[model samples]
Target: MDQISGVQQYHQLFGTKVYDADTAFEFLTIAVFQAGMSWKVAASKIPVFKQVFANFDYHKIAMFDEPDLEAIESNSNMIQNGRKIRSVLQNAKAAVQLEPEFNNLADYFWSFKPDKSEEGDRDTIGAVVAKDMKKRGFEFVGPTTMGLLLVGMGIIERRPNA
Candidate 1:
């Protein structure tokens, strides 16, 4: 599929949904894996990720021990990046911690949504969220990744470059 259609499909699949913490963590994981790769390539690996990562269940993922990490590392179907793989585990733990502060991961993420009149580019907005997430111990969440996440979540629209 072309980029536009691929993005449209992604938005249809992810953007329009109401996220609970599990779903929110799932999409955040997607954004992490999508970094430095095309959406098509990243999207293709999602099914396997879901299977290996216990359907993006943060609580389950938080419990993933070294054996689980080894299984994921040994899985030929996975992305195979050690750091990114570890980050998923780390982020899961971080997401679990968010429950007490914000009620849920979804609420914490959604609280960053900017108003329509906000005057900043996607990177600018994403940086704000990224900074906060880093403070809370989330990994693999740089500005660009978070920008894509925001767009994917439909918290912010993807705008054409000026």
Candidate 2:
């Protein structure tokens, strides 16, 4: 109602708000869900995900047992694909491992921002980052997905003032 696209609506909520690690996790969770689907579907499910995943705190989600994931699996409000739901925990766990290396999960994710020159070829940057994420034990982080995530984060955006 307020914007042209679901993604634009998403940006209206978050574009100017710089998030900490917890919120970054939430965004990434939705980003993963957005893969192979419309932004509308993924955006609609965010509130549900925030409630289910303890506001995307890596400390909490990383500790999620089978029962927790199962609960999400059974939640009718969610997109409910078992793999994506399960990956929330897996990805949280991976993010936890990166916290010590960087200041937090957000810093680690932000560190992969493609250089301005490299922005024109996001697929290449995404491939590189995706490989590293896979090496770090994250799931559902394919190159195309990573590229889209960068776009969502505004890290790969075209310069506005230019």
Candidate 3:
């Protein structure tokens, strides 16, 4: 599939739904894993990821210790990237920290949604958000990852032909 359809399919499958902070974190985690791999490959691991990550509950994940990381890193069903696993833990901790300033991670992320008329470059907005997220202690959240995250969350519309 082309990029447009790929994004559309992803949005249709995962984004067209009401999402809480946990769900938002799930999508962000998917984006993290999507780096250096196809979305299909990354998506195929969602079930195992959900099972291992405590249903993407950032609170639970934030509390994960070394044993938890070791277990995940050793799991054959997971992507087996130690850095990505560690980043997930870091991102979870960052998400938990957002609870004080925002209602939840979802609230903090949705705050970046562009107005309908202001749907300019997705990469530009993604970069801005990525910068803020890095400052807030999230890991593995660069511009490209943030762009995919926004697309997966339906925070930004996908171009029909790009």
Reference-based TM-score of each model: 0.87, 0.85, 0.89
CA lDDT, every model vs. true structure: 0.81, 0.77, 0.83
Worst 10 residues of 2 by lDDT: 1-10
Model 3: colliding residue pairs: none
- Per-residue alpha-carbon lDDT of model 2 for 1-162, expressed as tens digits? 432554555666554333478767767887789888986788877667778989778889999998888888999888869988888889999999996789887787678776667767777877888899999999988898777666656666633442
Which has the better lDDT: candidate 1, or candidate 3?
3
Candidate 1 lDDT score at position 39: 70
User: Which candidate ranks first by TM-score, i.e. highest?
Assistant: 3
Which has the better lDDT: candidate 2, or candidate 3? 3
Residue 61 miss distance in model 2 (angstroms)? 0.4
Pull out the clashing pairs in model 2: none
Worst lDDT run of 10 residues, candidate 3, spans 1-10
- List runs of model 1 lying over 4 Å from the truth: 1-11, 160-162
Clashes of 3: 0
lDDT of 1 by residue, 86-126 (tens): 99999999999987889888888888888878735778888
